[model samples]
Target: MKNTEQFIGKRVLVVGLAKSGMAAAGLLHRLGAEVIVNDARPLEGNEEAATLQALGIEVIGGGHPSDLLERGFDIIVKNPGIPYSNSLITQALERGLRIWTEVELAGLISEASIIAITGSNGKTTTTTLLYHMLNIGKKKPLIAGNIGTVACTVAEKAKNDEVMVLEASSFQLAGTENFKPHIAIFTNLYDAHLDYHGSTTEYLDAKLQVARNQTAEDFLIYNNDQEIVRSSVETMHAQKIPFSTEGKVVEGISADEEWIYWLGEPFISTKEIKLPGRHNLENILAATAAAILTGCKKTAIENVLSSFTGVRHRMQFVREFNGRTIYNDSKATNTLATKSAISSFKQPVILIAGGLERGHSFEELRPHMNNIRTVVAIGETAERFTEFAKSCGVEQSLLATTMEDAVKVAYESSSEDDVILLSPSCASWDQYPSFEIRGDQFIHAVMKL
Candidate 1:
């Protein structure tokens, strides 16, 4: 880590005790900051709170004390999941106090160059793929951010020779002030997280923060096919590098039906890529462009793209059982994602979907249901999704109470050479703690068959 004196002797208040929060508080305490952590959860049996307390950091738990801000903190390091609408956050804004997510801290302390990837849907896939490409190319790369690891924790131990590839979310980006990446990749933007961001414009603005602080010496690999993303980068200070899977581009990366081209020169053939779906192709193009900027060779990029099937729970191919191909896309928490997954396959699909009822129409999926032979719905949105499926002219629509049952129904409904997929077009919180747990249950059930 860089020997930065910015946090020295500063009074820092860390909001929320999530993984990122704990890491940030610890880092701040070590950086000579007088740190205090406040979490809504009760103090008793709170191991995280206890651990921080042991490190000489004050922990206030159970609830946000009404006058907590009166304690006078220099800056507030907030957990990204905590919305700006939170009372404490709102008051901080009213008080004119600076606020940030841990990504800013990571950027502040890390000696390594950062490669940040952000998008509505493909952040995880692109981050993971780029990390692999860099690793294969013998560039030491550490993976962090929304993919799982806390960015601050990884940045703490990162060496100057290493590259930090972060999967940034809109929530995280919204709180970042000086969090700039050496190379930034904006995969593609779509309508998502409107509830947290309050509007599509706000959400896009937050995602654009990935490159907001970059200078001309930096690089921004963006999706040229997305007009919003394309146009948004026009004012950015970074050297712009465009990637498009749609057609040829004047410069940077482009893909046609046959091959991927960099600077209009052929780089790799599309036939060599093992991962399915056009959405994934977009991810591959973005990752490849970033990898090239990082000096990764074509061999490194090809080795990963030619063999990497998919990220776990993101249209991941599970196994072929009883002449049926199974895929676990439990990460498809919205209709746009499900639509991409459904369009990835040409075989007849027995789809298991449905989750939290966000009160949004599934009508966006109607045009992509031609290959959907059967629909097994579950969770709070089950009934509504089943009805929507029937309306889409899918011959068989059934409701299942459990993941196992859904898998059973889908498998039974499938024919030889058919695809059985779990692509819930809603959040997993209706039945599972997270999409990962929902995906694990689906995978376990599939393995049992």
Candidate 2:
């Protein structure tokens, strides 16, 4: 913990009653800060608000009041998912309220050294792998941030000897001010969350913030292959360590077809890893860099890399039924992700894709169409995906109303030794609450077969 006394008697507002907001409110309240929690969900059936109220924290349910910002709170701990376009956030910015994401709050109080990972993709896998590496090294590491548990909640109990591995997002980083991680990993960059950030420049700016507060004493391990990623931090003062799958790097981590090279020394072999895709290769490189810098042994890194299957919903193997290998990649909620997943397999793939249309085109994925044997389009963007698939020379492109139907169609059409992959190139909001649920349904449907 940095200084708990700084928050004593300070007025703070915690906005949005999701996991992050609730955790922030409780942490601040316990730290002697006067905390007020608010959410748009109505008072009825609001279990989150009820819990905060029980903690003696003031709770405002039903809606975000227009005058809530005028209450003279000294600080605002906002849920990153709450868009800048939201009225509450707009008002707070207008009133010059010091806004912080729970990550920022965590950084202020955490005695544990933080290792934050951020990118458009591969953040969860890299963060999880780093945590596993630290565990193998006998370091007590806390896994928090965008994956599940709030960073602040985890930091509340974090010990000085422990390490906090966080899966940071642009949303979270966008609200951050002085959130500096001891070791920061920027996996790779792609244009994403344009709907929320409104433009590529704004989105990149948020992602770059992970390195802003870092100094020469701190470390930043980033992708050397991504031009945009490399250019973003040209002027950064932090000790830069580059990880590349594209070519060998003299001072950092690099990967050849056979092995990963750490500072020109042979590290781990790629053949031992189970996760598919070149994107996963990039993830391994970034994780390996961070792990080595944090004192993890090569044996520990290899042990996890070989044994670790993969994170769920991100090219997770479902089952083999009727000679076809089924894979659930519902986390591929963008064209780039779908393209990478498709590129991973040499075997013909019966791809089940499409979801809520977020104004992104399927054009980028067109080049990988040759690898796709069949297409099963589902959700709001089904027609768009189907049409695009046909235009890209896919022999058979079918539309399904449900995930079950998509699975069945893919199974029936797929041949022996083929892969039936559920790599939806859009979000799950049109039919399911999240990509996890969409993936679960895909797994269940595969099990039934």
Candidate 3:
């Protein structure tokens, strides 16, 4: 941590006590900030709150006092999930008080060079792949951000010689002011998280923050196929390294049916990659470009690409049993992702789909159901998926109230050489706390069978 003096004698309020919030509060307190932690949940049984209180930091719980900001804090470090429309946050903005997410703190203190990846999709896969590539290439990389680890937590222990591979979400990036990465990757943008951001423009603006402060010394590996992403970075000072699966870019990276080329030279054979899906081709190109920029050897990148099957809960292949191959893609929480998952295979698929009802139509999914042999629908969107499946000429459509039941029905509906896939096209909040838990249940059910 190089900038410890910045927080000395600062009065900071840490809002919403999740892992990120807790980490921020503790770090701020250690830096000599007068820290106060607050959460809407009651703090009586909250162990995190108790831990902070034990450190002599003030803790407020149950609700936000209307006059909480009147306590005259110098800054607020808010959890990413907390909206700007939040009462305290809105008020803080109106008063011109500095507000940020903990990622800003990560940038301020960390001695490591950051490699940040952000997009509507493919952030996790690209981040994970780059980490593996750098690990094999001996880059001394540390993984952090929205891929489960908190950025500030990882940044605290990071060394100057190391590279921090971060999976940044729009929520996290939105609160960043001076959080610039040494090498940034913009995978691809689509309509997502409009509810929290209020519009597609606002959401895109937040995502673009990943490269906002980069100087000409930095490198930006972006998706040239996405006009929105391509045109948006036109004015950025970072040296742009474009990647595309749709067409060849002589100055950057591109892929054909045979090989992935870098700077107009063949880098690796396409057949060497084990990860499935054409959408992933874009991710592969992006990660490979970043890896090359980070000095990863071609052999190291090839070794990772040939062996990395997939990220867990994101087109992850489970074992083949009873002559049928199963895949868990519970991370497909929207139509676009589900389409990608479905289009990855040519074999007949017994697809388990459906989840939370967001009043969105399944019509967008209709054109991609050519290989869907049977549909096992579950959760709040079950009925709508079932109807959509029938309309697409699927022979069988079954409904289950739970993931386990859905797995059972899907297995029964499958045959030799068929693919049994769980790629729910909706969020998991209607049935489970997160998509990871829902995917775990699917894997467990597959094991039981």
Candidate 4:
């Protein structure tokens, strides 16, 4: 761990009182920094602010006062979700104050070996799988980052012998300067979060930061199949180990029609995997390669490959009612994700799609519409999805007023041999706060049938 004395008598400001913000404030205080927290949300009934105040940390709530920038804070720890476009962040940058995310702070203090995962999709699934794989191999893995647990909290509680598997996002990766992972895994990149990063180039640049600080001793397990992913890390300093679903990669992991191969040897059969989708097969291959690099037993890797069903909300199977299989892929917040979800099944799909538009179109989803028997549209993009579906040669499309109606319509439209899939090609911000809630509502509606 780095010296806490460097923080002693230093002035620090924590922006946004979310999970990462709270943990960072407490850590700074414990390290002897004079910490002040600024959150745009109102202070009344704000438990996080109250807790910080109780610890003698000054809390400014409701707004980010412009005068706060002149307070001579030595550093600012901003939550990753709070965009760089935020005024306070811009002001901090202009004033030349060192800005960081909690992940950067975690890297400084953590004694445990860190294995970080980042991508446009499959971050949570691959991170969870690797955590489980390490556990079965008795590696004592602790999971954190975008999957929910605060990194600073995990770093403080982590043991030296333990390994930390972090599910990092582009938001989290953008704020780091010196943060580096011992083992960094890049699951394929896609067109995502363009709203925040402003462009595809910036988004990919942020994702590459996961391997930024690694050395020759560290490992970078990545998907060579993704041209963007492969190109970004071409000159990386870490030992590169590639995973691919598109034929053989010398001295790396690859998969064919029926089997996953590792280092020129058959590792696991595709038939043993419970998770649906070729995309998930990609996720599994990435996780397996990382696990093998970390010395996880082949038996443990096979067990997870064969038995781990999947993470919730990402192509998760809900139920089988009357002969139709229902899948809740509410995490498919982009067209690429929805396309992958729809292409997973061999049977005809009754696709339930539509949600908040993130400047992404359903045009990419059109090519896969041949497998979609019908589409039940909902939320803000319903009409847009319907038009896209029709243009793609889909003969049947229905617009539902509610999620329950969408589920009902899908089930009613599906035959015994068909699949009812809830893979929204857009985000849930229009109706639900998160994809988890959207997925839960879908499951609830399916249960009532």
- Structure candidate 1, residue pairs in collision: none
lDDT of 3 by residue, 136-237 (tens): 999999999988679998988899999999999999999999999999999999988888999999999999899999999999999999899999999999
Worst 10 residues of 3 by lDDT: 359-368
TM-score of 4: 0.95
Residue 301 error for model 4, in Å? 1.2
Q: Per-residue lDDT for 279-382 in model 1, tens only?
A: 99999999999999999998999999988988999999899897998999999998899999999988899999999998988999999998999999999999
lDDT of 2 by residue, 253-312 (tens): 999888888888887788888777888888888888888888988899888888776789
RMSD of each: 1.5, 1.9, 1.5, 1.8
Off by over 4 Å in 3: none
Off by over 4 Å in 2: 321-323, 357-360
Candidate 1 residue 100 Cα shift, in angstroms, is: 1.0
C-alpha positional error of residue 26 in candidate 1 after TM-score superposition, expressed in Å:
0.6
Where model 4 places Cα greater than 4 Å from the true spot, the runs are 357-360
Candidate 2, after superposition: displacement of residue 202 in Å?
1.8
Residue 258's lDDT in candidate 4: 83
Tens digits of per-residue lDDT for model 4, 55-165: 999999999897888888888999888988899998888888798999988898898999999987889899989999999999999999988689988998888899999
Global CA lDDT computed for model 2: 0.89
